[model samples]
Target chain A: MKLTFPHLGNAYIAVKALLDELGVDYIIPPFNNKKALEIGIKNSPEFACLPLKINIGNIIQAYREGADTVLITGGCGPCRFGYYCEMEREILQDAGYDIGFITIDAPRGISLKEYFSQLLKITNGINIYKIAKAVKNTTEIAILVDQLEKLTFKMRSIEACRGDTDSVYRDFQQEIRLINGAQSIKKYISQTSQKLTNIRCNTGIKPLKVGIVGEIYTTIDSYTSFNLDARLGNMGVEVDRSVTVSNWVVEHMLKKVFHLPRDLKYAEAAKPYLGAMIGGHAQETIGNSIMYSQKGYDGIVQIYPLTCMPEIVAQSILPAVENDYGIPVLTLIIDEMTGEAGYLTRLEAFVDLLNKRREMAASDR
Target chain B: MRTGGQPIEALRKGMEYLAGQLGNIEIRGAGTTGSGRQLASVIIGADIVKNEITAHAVAAQNLVPEVKTILEIGGQDSKIIILKNGVVYDFAMNTVCAAGTGSFLDRQASRLNIPIEEFGSYALRSDSPVRIAGRCAVFAESDMIHKQQMGHRVDDIVRGLCQALVRNYLNNLAKGKLIAEPILFQGGVAANVGITAAFEEALGKKVIIPEYYDVMGAYGAALIAKRKMEKSIDTNFKGFDACLRDYSARSRECSGCSNVCEVIELFSNDELLASWGDRCGKWSSRLEGRPLVAR
Candidate 1:
C-alpha cells in the first residue's frame, strides 16, 4: 500500500523513519500552501477547524501523487482531533476517493490484546525481531529530532558567528534525514554537540529567555506560526518549548506500558491558575507558562489559531500569570489573514519590552 | 496589479512628514506601529516598535483619560479594546473575516460611484435602511447588490451597509466584554459618520471620535516614544536626512533546510544597512555595527 500522512512539524521525521524501516512504499504530501488551504476549505465541512481542513487537503494532494493508503494517529483529548479520522474518512468517501486508512491508537491507552491486534496488521509478514528493531529506531528518531531542536535553541543564542548555529543546525537536520536505524542517532547527536562547542558565543551578555506555550497544533507546527521559535532565537533570545512531538509520543505511548511515575508537575503548577483540563491543552498552556516563569524565563509567547476555545481561555488567564510571576506574556492569535509583517512587529516589540525590563531590573539591583 | 509600491518608500515619506511637523527638533525618541512598523523601525531607527493594539490603547488613554473602551476599525481589520484604570485590560481583534473594515466600505462606495469621503454623508441622509447580510463579505456584497437592483435609494443602501458593518463588528468583537464608556471610536473607519451613527444607535450611547481618528495608531506610537524617552538616555531616531538616501529591499530564498526561509536585505547608497526575514538567524546574525548613513 502507498501510505501518506499530514505534515505536523518534525513528527514527519520519525514517521518517515518508521515507514522506511517497515519497507512500505509511501507518499509524503507537498508542504502546505494556499493551494492546499483552498482545496481543504472547498472540500471540508463549513464549520470544521483549520487543521482538519488542511489535513484533508494534504490527503487529497497525496492521492494525486499516487498514495492510496492514509495513515493517521488516534487522538488523546476532547479536541475535535479525536474525531478527525472518522470525519475525514466519511468526507473522502463522499468525494469519491477510495483510500484505505490505518488509524494507530496509542498502545498505552489500549489493552495489550487490542494493541497487538492493531500492530498485527502492519507486522503481518515481517519477523518479530525486525519489527522490534523498527520500533526502536522510530522512537530514537523522535528523541533525536527533539534533541537537535532544543540544542539549536540554546546554541542560536550563544554562537558567536552569524550563521554558525544555523548552519550547524541545518546540516544536522540534513545529516539525520539520510540516516536509518537507532544506533546512528546517538553518534549524530554527539558529533553535532562537539561541533556546537567548537563555535564561540559572547560570554559577557546574558541571553534573554522566552517560553512558548499554546494549542498543540499551532505550537507543534513551526510553519503554522511562521517559525516563531527561530525568529526569537535570531533576536538572541533562547526559547524553551514545553511541547514536542517526542514528548507526546512518550506521554501517550510509553508512560502506561513502562509504569513510569507520571510527570503531572505541569498540572500541579497550573492548579493555581486553572484548576482542571477544560479541553485542548489549556491546562498545559497555563502549567507550562508558570513552570517557565519559575525557571526564570523572561517572557512567555502563547500562539494559537483564532477562535481556538482553549487558547482564548488561556489568553484570558495569561495576564494574571504574567503579573503574579513578574514575567511578560504576549498572546498572538493567527488566522488565514495573519500577515507576517504584523506578526514580526509584535515579536520585535515584545523582545524590546523584555530587554527594557531586564535593563531596569539590573539597574535596580 | 502591482500598483502599490514597496512599504520602505512610503515609510521614508512618513518619517519625513513626522519630522516636518516637529520642525527640525530632535525627536526625543521614536516608536512605530501598524503592519509596517518593522520596515518603519528599520528605516527610522525607532526606539520602540509596538503592535497596533498597544499603540491605539495608549493613544486613546492619553487623549481621553476616561476612555474605558476603544473600538478600532482600520482598512483591513477591526478590534475592541477594553481598558481598566488606564491600562489595556483586554482586547479582541477580528479574525477569518474582513467584512466590517474600511476596505469593504471603500469597495462598495466606489462600486456605487460615490466618493468615499461623501459616502458617510449619504448614509446620514437615509430614512429607510434595508437589512443587508454582514456575517461574511460575499453575502454582504450580494445582499447589497440585491437591494440596489430592487431600486432602493443609494443613501438607504449605504446606510444599510454601514449598519451591517457595525453589527458584524460588535458581534464578532465586543461579545460579553465589560465594554464600558466613554467609548472612543477610532481608526480609518472612524472617518465614516454612518458607522459612528450606527454604533451610537446600537450601543445606545455616544461614541466619541478622537481628534486624529484616522491617525490614532501613530499618535499612540508617539506617546509610547515619549514614555520611553523619559527613562532612556537618547532617541534612536535616524533623523530626517535618512529619508533622502536611495534605499532598496530584496528577498532571497534560503535553501538551507526544509523550511526554505526567505531572507530580506536592505541596501542604502549601495551599502548593506539591514537584513532580516529568515526565522533562523543565519543571515541577520551576520549583522555587525549599525549602518551609519543616518548620521
Candidate 2:
C-alpha cells in the first residue's frame, strides 16, 4: 500500500523515516503552497477550518501522485479535528478516489484490538523486533528535528550575519526531502546543526523574547502562520512556540499508549485561567501564555484560524492576563482571507510595543 | 483617493506650503508611515520608515501623555490602539473589510450630492435617524439608498450612516477591549463631527480630537524621525527639491518561480530609484549600496 500524510512542519521527516524503515512505498505531496490551498478550498466544506481544508488538498495531490492509502492521527477532542479523517474519507469517496485510511487514534477511545489492527496495517507483517527498532529510530529523528528547529529559532535572532541562519535552514529543508532512511536523516540533521553553530552570533545583545501560543496545527505549520517564526527572528526577536511536532507526538500519542504521566506544568500554569482542556489546545494556549508571562517574555502572540472555538475563548481571556501580568498579548485570527499586509502590520506593531516597553523599563530602573 | 502618481504631487504641494510658511528652515529629518510608507520614503529619501499603527500610537501618546485608547479611521482602513503607562499595549486594525472607512463616507456623500465636509452637519440636524446595516459596505450603501428612495430625510439617513459606521468599528476592531478614558481620535475621518458624535454616543466617553487630527500619522512619523536623528547627526532629507524631480512607477510579474510576485519598479527620470515587492528579493537586493539619486 502506498502511504501519504499531511505536512506538519518537520514531522514529515520523522514520518518519512518511519515509512522508509517499514519498506513501504509512499509519495510525499508537494509542500503546502498556493495550489494546495486553492485545491483544498475548492473541495473542502466552506466552514471547515484552514487546516482541514489543507489536509484534503494534500490528500488529493498525493492521490494523483499514486498514493493509494492515507495514514493520519485521530483525536477525540471537543474540537471538529476529531472528525477530520471521517470527513476526508467521505469527501474523497464522493470524488471517486477510492483510498484506504489508517487512523491511529488514542487507545483510550478505541479497543486495543482495533488499535493493534490499525498498527498492524502500518507494520505490514514486519516482525515485532523490526517494528520496535523502527519506532525507536523514528522517535529519535522526531526529537532531533525538533531540537534543530529550536536551535535555529534561537540562533536566527542573534546571528551576526543577517541571512546566515536562514540560508542554512533553507538548505537543510531542501536536503531533507531527498534524504532517505532514519540514519541518513539523523546524520544530515547533525551536520545542519553543526553548520548552524558555526555562524557568528552577537551574544551581548539581549533580543526580545516572544512566545507563540495558539492552536496546535496552525502553530506547527509554517505555511499556515506565513513563516511567523522566521519573520519574528528576522526582526531581531527570539521567538518560541509551545507546540512542536515531537511535543505533539509525545503529549498526544506516546504518553497515552505508554500510560506515562501527563506533564502538568502547562496545566498548572493554565489553571487560574482555564481549568480543563476544552479541546484543540485551548487550555495549553492559556497555560503557555501564563507560563511565558511568568518567565518574563517581552510579549505573547496568539494565532488561530478564523471560527476556531477554543482559541476564541483563549483570545477573550488573554486581556485579563495581560492586565494582571503587565505583559502585552497580541491575538491574530487568520484564515484564507487574512491579508499579508495587515498581518505584518500587527506583528511589527507588537514588536515595536515590546521594544518600547523594555526601553521604558530600563530607563525607569 | 491618491493614485500611485498623486502622492508625489501631494507631498510636493505639502512641502511647498510648509516652505512658504517656515521660510528658509533647514530640514533636519524625514520619515514616512502608512500603507504608502515605502513609496513615500523612496520619493522623499526619508531616513526612517514605520507602519501606521506605530505611527498613530506614537502620535496620540505624544499629544496626550496619558492617552489610553486611540481610534484612527483613515481613507481605506480603521484601527484601534490600546495603550497603558505611556506605551502601546495592544492594537487591532480592520481586515479584509473597508465597510466604515472615510472613503466609504466620501462615496456616500458624493452620491447624495452633498459636500463631504458638510455631510456630517446634516446628521447633526436630524433628531430621529433611520437604521442602516453596517455589516458590509455594499449592504450599507443599498440600505442607505433604499431609505433615501422611501422619502426618508437625507439628514436622518446621514445620521444613521454615521451611527452604523461607529457601531461597525466598535464591533469589528474594539471587540470588548476596554475603551478607556482620555481617548484620542485622529485620522482623516476624525474631521466628521457626525461620526465623532456617533462614536461619543456609542462609547459614552468624550473622544478628544487632536489639533492636527487629519495629519496625525505624518506627525507621528516626524516625531519618530526626530527621535531617530538623536543618535545619528546625518540627515537623508534629500531636500524639498527631490519633490520637483519627475517620478514614475511601473510593475511587472516576475517569471522567476511559481510565486509570480509582482515586482514594482520606481523610477526618477529614467534612473531606477528602487524596486520591491518580490518575495525572493532578487529585484530589491540589486539596488543595494547604490546612490538613490543619480543626479
Candidate 3:
C-alpha cells in the first residue's frame, strides 16, 4: 500500500526515515505552497481552519500522484486539530477516494491493543519487531532533528560569521533528506556539530533572547511563521523555541509507554494567568511565556493561525500575563493574506524593543 | 489606491504630503503599520515597524488616555484592541471576512445610489430599520437586495446595512470580550454616522470618534515613530526630501534552489537600498553594509 501524509515541519523527515526503514512504500507529498493552499481552499468549507485545508490539499495532491493509504496523527483534545483527521477522512470519502487510513495518537478510551492494531495495519505483514526497530530509529531521528534545530537557534545568534548556521543547516537539511541508515545520520550530525564548534562566535556580545510559543503545527511549519526563529537568529537574537516535533512525540506519543514525568513546569508557570489547558498549546504558551520571563528572556512572541480557537483564548490571557510578568508579548496571527513585509517589520521592531530593553537593563546594572 | 509603476515613488509622494501637512514638526525615526508596513519601512527608513494591533493600541493610548477598548474598522479589515492602563491587554483583527469593514459599507452605498458620506445620515432618517442578514458579505448583499425589492425605504435599507455591519463586527471580532465603555471608534468607517448610530443603539452606549478617524492608522504610525525616536540614539528619518526623490522597486526570481523564491530589491538611483524576500538570505545580506543613503 502506498502511504501519504501531510507535512508539518521536519516531522515528515522522520516519517520518511520510518517508512523507508520499514520497507513500506510511501509517497511524501510536495512541500506546502500557494498551489497546495489554493487547492485546499477550493475543496474546503468556507470557515475551516488553515491547517485542515492544507492537509486536505496535500492529500488530494498526493492522491493524484498515486497514493491510496493515508497516515495521520490523531488527538482527542479540545483543539479543532484533534478532530481534523476524522473530518479529512469524511471529506476524502465524499470526494470518492477509497483510501486506507492509519491513525497514531495517544490512546483515549481505547487500550494500547487497539492503538497497536491501527498502527500495525500499515506494516503489511512485516515482522512487528522490525517495525518496532524502525519506530525507534524514527524517534531517534526526530530527537536529533530537534536537537540540530535548537543548536542552530543558539549558534546562529552568536556566530561571528554571518549565514554560517544557515549554510550548515541548508547542507544538513539536504543531507538528511538523502542520507539513509541510522549510523550515517548520527555521523553527519556529529560532523555538523564539530563544524559549528569550529565557526567563529562573538564571545562578549550577549544577544537579546526571546521565547517562541504558539500553536504546534504553525509553530513547527516554517512557511506558516515565515521562518520566524531563523529570522530572529539572523537578527542576532538567541531564540528559545518551546515547541518541537520531538517534544510533541514525547508528550503526545511516547509518554504513555514510558510513563514519563509530566512536565508541569509550564503548567505551574501559567497558573496565575491560565488555570488549565484551553487546548492547542494555550496553556503552554502562557506557561512558557511566564517561564521565559522568569528565566530573564528579553521578550516572547506568540505565533498562531488566524481565528485559532485555543490561541484566541491565550491571546486574551496574555496581556494580564505581560502585566503581571512585566514582559512584552507580541501576538502574530498567521493567515494566508499575511504580507511578509509587515510580518518582518513587526519582528524587527519587536527585536529593537527587546534590544533596547536589554541595553537599558545592562545600564541600570 | 493609485496604481503606479514605482511603489517607492508613491510612498515618497505620500511622505512628502505628510511632511507638508505637518509643517515644522521634525519627522524623527519614522514608523509604519497596516498591511504594507515592510514596503513603507524600507522606503522611509522606519525606526520601528510594528503590527497594526500594537500601533492602533499605542495611538489610542496617545489620543485618549482613558480608552479601554478600540474599535477600528478600516477599508478592508476591522480590529478590536482591548487595553488597560495604556497597555495592549488583548486584540483581534478580522479574519477572511470583510463583512464589518468599510468595503461592505462602500459597496452597499454604491448599490443604493447614495454617496457614502450621506449613507450614515440616511440611516438616521429611517423610521424603521429592516433586518438584513449580516453573517457573510454575500448573504448580506442578497438579503439587502431582497429587502429593496420588497419596497423597503432606501433610508431603512441603509440603516439596516449599518446595523448589519455593527452586528457582524460584534459577533466576529468583539465576541466573548467585555467591550468596555470609553471605546474609541477610529478608521475609514468611523466617518459613517449610520454605523456610529447603529453601534450606539446596539450597545446602548456612546462610541467616541477620534478627530482624525480615517487616518488613525497613519496617526498611530506617527506616534510610534515619535515614541521610538524619543528613546533611540539616532533618528533615521531619512529627511523629508526622500519623499520627493525617485526610487524604484524591482523583483527577480532567484532560481538558485528548487524553491525559486522571488527576491525583491529596492533601488534608489540604481544603488540598492534593501533587498529581501529571499529564502536563502543571499540578496538581503547585500543590504547589511549600506548606509542610510535616502537622507
Candidate 4:
C-alpha cells in the first residue's frame, strides 16, 4: 500500500526510512509551498494555525498522488497541535477527499503496553528489529543533514566575506547528501564538521550577528519568515536561528524526562506574558531572544503569525527585554499580505543599521 | 507608579512617554486581541479585550466603512469575514494551512531559484494559464513539473498556480459562505498580483486590496483600542518607554484539581499584577480581584 505523511521537519525523514525498511511504498509530501497552502487554505477552516494548513495541503497532495493512507502523529496536551489529526480529518472529509489517516499518539494517555499493538495495526507484522533499525538510521540521517546545513550556513558568512560562498555552499550541500548515508550520528557529525572546517573563510572583521527566536515552525520554516536568514546573509549579516525541530523535540521530551537544563525553561519566563496555555511555544521563544541578546547578539528579530496568541504575548513583553538589553528588536507579524518588497526593505534597513553600528564600534575600539 | 518596584516604575515611566506622544488627544476607550490581549489590556488598561475576528472586523468596518467581505491571511493562517451593514455576520479562518499563505509562496520562490519579489511579476507575464492542480502543494509541484515537461510557458504555469490557489481558497474557506462584492482583501497575500488576479478571475470581479494590508491586524487592534479609549474615562496606554523595563513573568502549577493547570503570574516588581492559565477560573479570577465562581 502506498503511504503518505505530512511535513513536520524530520518526522517525514524518519517515517520515510521506516516505510523503506518495512518494504512498503510511500511518498512523502513535498516541502511546504504555495500550492499546498492554497489547497490547505481552501480545504481548512479559516482560523486554524499555520501548521494545519500545510498538513492539509500535504495530505491532499498525497491523496491526489494515489496514496491511500496518510500517517500522522497524535498528541495530548494543552497545545492545540494535539487535536490536529481530528481537525485535519474533518476538513479533508468536508472537502470530499477520501483517504485513510493513521495517527500515533503518545502512549502516555493509553497503556504503554498497547503502544506496540497500535503500531502493529499499521506495520502488519513487520519485523520489529528492522523497524527499529530504520528508525535509528532515519533519525541519524536527519540529524546529520541538519548538522551539515547549520555548519554550511555558519561557513557561508565567512565564505561570502571571502567571495566564495556560492561555490562552497554548493559543495557543502552535496557533501551533506552524501553524509546522510553515514552509519552513525557520530560519524555524520564528525565528517560534516570536518567539511565545514576545510572551507577557507576570510575572517577579516567580525560582522554584526543577529539571533532569531520565535515559534518553532515559523522560526525554521523559510516560507514563514520569507527566508529571512538568506536575506540577512545576502546583506552580509550572520543570522543565528535559536529554534530547531530537533531542539524542540529534545526539550519537550527527553529534557523533561531527564530534568535537564539543556532546554531553557522558557515556559517559566513566559508564564506572566502568556498567563495560560494559549497553545504555542511563544514563551520559550521570547525567553530565548532574551538569552541571545544577553549573550550579546547585536539585534534580534521575532517573526510570528499576525494573530498568533503565544507570539502576541511574547511581543508585549519583548519591548522590555529589548530596552534592558539595549538590543534593537524588530517584530514582524506575518500574514498573507507580507510583500517581498516590504519585507526586503525592512531587512535591508535593519542590516544597514546593524552594519553602521558594527563600523562605529570598530572605529571606537 | 511609585507603588510598584523598579521594573513597575520603569514600565510606568515608559507608559508616560507613550502618553506624551499622543499630546493632548484623550484616549477615551480601548480594545485588545491576540494571545496577549488580556495581558495587554491589563497593562494598557483597555476597556475591551475581544477575539481577533471581532477586533479585525471592527477595524475593517471603521477603515473601509463600506467593506462587504473581508479576506485576511497572515504568516501562518488565513481568515474570511462577511459583514452586513458594518457588523460581522459570518466568518471563516484557515489557521492550519500554509500553502496559500505568504510564507508558502516565499518557500516556493526560493526553491525555484527566484526571488519572492519577482514571483508575482513572473505570473503577470504568463500568456496561457497552466492548469496546475492546486489542491495540495506536493501534488501541485509534481504536476507543475509535468506541465513544464509538456512545454508550458513558466508565466502560464505560474498564473495557473495562482488561479488554483484562488480556487482552493474559495472551495475550502469560502464554501457555503456568501462571497459578495465590494470584497476587501486585506492581509499579506493581497499584495501578490498573481494571487490577486487569480482571485479576481475566480470571483469574476474586482477584489479591493486595502492600503497597509500587512499591518492591518495590528492597525485594526490599535484602532479598536483607540476607539475604546474615546469611550473610556481614562486611556490605559502604558506608554512607549514601558518597553525599557525589566519586566518578567513566573508560573506556578495550581493544585486546585486534577487539571493541575499551570498558572502564569505577572509581576512588575515583586507584586503580582496579574495571573492566568487556570482552566476553571481558579487563579485568573483571584488575581484580578474577582471572587471565583463555580461553574
Candidate with the greatest DockQ versus the true structure: 2
Candidate 3, A1-365: lDDT as tens digits: 89999988878878887888777788878777667788888878867877887898889889889999889887777487777778888988988888766777732534566656766788776777887788788889889888878888889899886787877777776667677666677678778877877777999988889999989888888766788889999899989878888888877777755567767789888887788877889999999998899999888999988779889889888878887888888788887677776467567657755665666666779
lDDT (tens digit, per residue) of candidate 3 on B200-276: 99989889998988778777888877866778668766777765666777899876543467888887789878887
Q: At residue B269, give the lDDT of candidate 2.
A: 81
What DockQ does every candidate get?
Answer: 0.23, 0.42, 0.14, 0.01
TM-scores of all predicted structures = 0.77, 0.93, 0.77, 0.51
What value does the lDDT take at residue A275 in candidate 4?
A: 51
Docking class of 3: incorrect
lDDT of 4 by residue, B85-170 (tens): 45554455553345566666766667567776778888999878988887776777788889888988778877887887777677
Report lDDT per candidate. 0.80, 0.86, 0.80, 0.65
Whole-structure CA lDDT of model 3? 0.80
Which regions of candidate 2 fall more than 4 Å away from where they truly are? A106-108, A111-113, B4-25, B241-275, B278-295
Q: Lowest-scoring 10 consecutive residues by lDDT in candidate 4 chain B?
A: B1-10
Look at candidate 1 and tell me the lDDT of residue A109.
51
List, residue by residue over B1-295, the lDDT tens digit for candidate 1: 0104578767767667767787867567888888766667777788887788878887898889989999999888888887655556556677657999988998999989999999999999999899999999989999999999999999999999999999999888886666688999998889899999999999999999988998899898989888878996687777888877888888888765545667888888889877777665556654434222110
> What is the TM-score of chain A, computed separately for every candidate?
0.91, 0.97, 0.94, 0.83
How do the residues A66-179 of candidate 1 rate in per-residue lDDT, one tens digit apiece?
999888876556466766888889999999999988777741356645654655566557766786687778888788778878888888787665567767766765676566
Cα lDDT for residue A99, candidate 1: 95
